[model samples]
Target: MKLLFLACLSPKTGNYTTAERIRSHIESAGHSCELRDVADFHSPSDLAHLVSQNPPFEGALAIHLFKAGRLLLDLRLPFGVIFGGTDINEDVKDEQKRVVMEQVLLKARFAVAFTEKLKEEAEFVLVSPDSKIYVQPQGIQTEVAEQFCWTEFLRSSEWHSKNLHNILIIIGPKVDPALTAEVEAVVKRATGVFLAQERSQQELHAAMKRCYAVVNSSVSEGMSAAILEAMDLRVPVLARNIPGNAAVVKHGVTGLLFSSPQEFVHQSQRLLSDQELRERVVRSGKLYVEEHHSVKQERETYQRLVDKLHKAQFLA
Candidate 1:
């Protein structure tokens, strides 16, 4: 079966990585899955034209409900949806987007949330039934560039650090500009802070491996892929205390959570000064990722979903 996978494909972002990973999973099951950036299509008509083009897609899957799943409505093909961070958390607060998302959920054959908290939120906010929603945590995988040097990276960025612990703060494209600017302002006051922007996955992984700790200051998340990747790479994480972050980071166990900018600084200092705490969390974090976010398990889950879709198609 040929499948069409639609997602926000911003360069060097989590959604793009996820779309690619799921595409690989579908393809591994002997299906041809075409990944297209959701930004390219403006309306349902645009998607209809693409679907009408050569060979046609037997099934479709979209990452974000309103952004991608909206296009799937009234289309002939069967489709599924995976909730994006903002759609469930921030976007639903808006009356218009909430209506659209509710419609999308109603029409979708299935929907996925990365965490159980998100699933419950979606069901409560969007009034979606439990039977339609599945909780499939994002899979974790990391590969550091063999030749990448931390010193060279710092040099390229014109950052000169003398034995100071390197703390990485990622600036994702989807984050609110005001919130991002505020977070940057606070984090930059600390020593050895690297504000990473538009880095390839390899570079991000390499930096995470060498950094003293990775920080997530986002106001909301759909299970941050970076936090999971940081854990998989054995890097300690310091995340903002949001429901999404809370779902993954068990305070002082998997990672530390901070409720404010001041707490983030305090936690950073504690993690850096206390080697025993750092080692314990890093070890437990890695073990957690291995047990809960394995690539093989993720692949199998999607494969099972695809097979179910295929069986439904055959019966139809």
Candidate 2:
């Protein structure tokens, strides 16, 4: 079967990485899968033109429900959805987007969420009994470039400080220019806080491998691919105490969680000073990733789902 996969293929973002992984999984199952960046299409007519120009795709899949699913509505092709964090957590707050998302869910053959909590959130939007949502955690795999020089990376980013032992890197979405400048100014005043600019996946993994700890301070998440990747790379994580982060980081066990700025400071101090605790968390965190977020398992799950989708499409 030929499949069409739509996603926001922005470089260095989680959605692009997830779409790539799933596309590989589908192709590995002996199917032809073509991935297209949804950013290229302005409307359903654009997608319709592509479909008409090429051989018809037997099935379709998308990462974000509202962003990508809206384009699938008029295609009249069997398609599934994978939840992008902001669509359920942030975008649904708008009544118009929520209504459109509801229609997309009702029309979709199936949907996928990264965590059970996210799946439950999706269920609330998809109240119809026939709507099926699967809970599939993001898979973890890390490859650190051997020649990646930590000192060179720091220098390139304009951090000339020789004291690199306790460097704390902040990784998050890009904000407005004014807000970003304000944040960068504050970070510059601090001793060792490094604000990461956009980097390729290989560079990001190398940076994660070298950092003292990976910190996630996002206001919301579906399930953080960064946290999982950090754990997989055997780096201790300090994440915000949100449901999505909490679902992965068992406080003081796998990693540390902070609800407030003071808590984050306290936890960071504890993680740095207490060598035993740091070692224990790093060990356990890597183990958890190996067991729960292995690439093999994620691929198998998608392959099974694709087969099921094929069967359903055949019967219909």
Per-model tally of clashing residue pairs: 0, 0
lDDT of 2 by residue, 79-111 (tens): 888888888788889989988888888888888
Least well predicted 10-residue stretch by lDDT in candidate 2: 151-160
lDDT of each: 0.84, 0.84
Q: Which parts of model 1 are misplaced by more than 4 Å?
A: 151-162, 166-196
Candidate 1 local lDDT, 17-94, one digit each (tens): 999999999999999999999889999888888897788778889999998999888788878899999897888988
Tell me which residue pairs clash in candidate 2. Answer: none
Per-candidate TM vs. native?
Answer: 0.90, 0.91
